[model samples]
Target: MGRYTMKSVSLNRLPIGSGLPKICIPIVAHTQEEVMKTAVQVVRSPADLVEWRLDFFDSLSPETVLETATELRQMLHGLPLLATFRSHREGGQQQTDDSAGIRIYHCLMDRQLAEAVDLELSQPADIRRSILSLARQTDTKVVMSYHDFRRTPSQKTIEGILGKMAAEQADIAKIAVMPQTPADVLRLLSATVSARSRLNIPVVTMAMGPLGKLSRISGSLTGSAITFGILDHASAPGQIEAGLLKNFLDELTVDQ
Candidate 1:
């Protein structure tokens, strides 16, 4: 456990990443009030951070997006935000093409509402670096992410993705995969251990779906620093609710 020195990030003054239970509540609202109310629920759920899935913004015009982002940031007050535009190809709501992906990525980063932004690791280095640079303009951290929808990749592949993230100066590296069997879960867990042992940057790793549920619970032990949860609808296809996530993690961390 000493390997992971959980640090705190002050968001307008609220603290994040303080070795405490981080309930990352996902948001999927279209209206300003809807999104704002959801943020309120996030506080009610006692989440450590809020992750706004921008792909869910149905009526989100650029102007509206900026306006909503401003309003959401204000309503959030001090809580840190992690805004993401996960491409549908990567299991997100936005079914965007390459050019469109780049556009949305840049647009979101330019606003600087989020304390951190999640960018697809598969994106070209230039694109990734560009968005990351925008983050720097606002002193935001970049969360480079990789998601394997079809199946889990080999341990070596996972490590490579993490290495790339580090090389790109990512603040956090996240990897998620769908496990077809129990053994797949083991590979993911082992990868987490390997990454933690060799790298210093924080990571968020998980194996999705029913077969991979155990990984979610044992994740903290394996070196996953954050957990993903949804109170109502999941931004991603398969995820447990906040209460369920809290329950599972609680049981896993119980005095063993």
Candidate 2:
């Protein structure tokens, strides 16, 4: 594909997709104390943003989720917070129905608990649209995501998924897939580059597992504008530590 450029989306003053890929660290804690402690550590790290994986929390009630998200936002101290309730089918911590998931999304957005929110693309079409509309109304960026824990799909399938997400008016399109071979990783990166050239929104794509670690570091060169790195713990496989990941990105920038 020819040279591709992605439009940037501002999150709490940080401009994503402007230059080097931003590093987003996830807080997967089970309790308020754990979340607070981890948030403190993340704020001190070189992470560009923070993602609160709300599914990891024991309580899923609207009140508890909002309260926890508010605390996380406060502890972040201006670091853009991304709220995500990844479903179990998508490698998330909780097994929730569409109704429950939508309720949680509304609760978080209504309170402006996070600067951005992640909504899975596999949910019912109406639910996805509703959530996106709610996010827009609240001025919260939406990260429309697709996950494949078993294997990476063909480039065509991946591209189509990205297109679907963009067509939904998502602020960002994200895909994470498991790669069993080196070629699988290449396919993932190629699809990301292709999708980036065709869509207006920024794309975040990753090839999960040890065999796919290279994609995590080199994604910025291809098309992905953001990569997840670990702070206190990892939310996904193949995630490098935040400090080490920052060092790698810095070195790559200088070389380029």
Q: Of the candidates shown, which would achieve the greatest lDDT relative to the real structure?
A: 2
For model 2, how does the per-residue alpha-carbon lDDT over 179-237 read when each residue is reduced to its tens digit? 98888999999998788778899989999989888888875577688889997678999
Report the lDDT tens digits of candidate 1 across residue range 36-63: 8897777778566788888778754577
Off by over 4 Å in 2: 1-6, 254-256
Worst 10-residue stretch by lDDT in candidate 1?
12-21
Judged by whole-model lDDT over C-alpha atoms, candidate 2 comes out at 0.86
Q: How far is candidate 2 from the true structure (C-alpha RMSD, Å)?
A: 2.3
* Regions of candidate 1 where Cα sits further than 4 Å from its true position: 1-3, 6-21, 98-108, 254-256
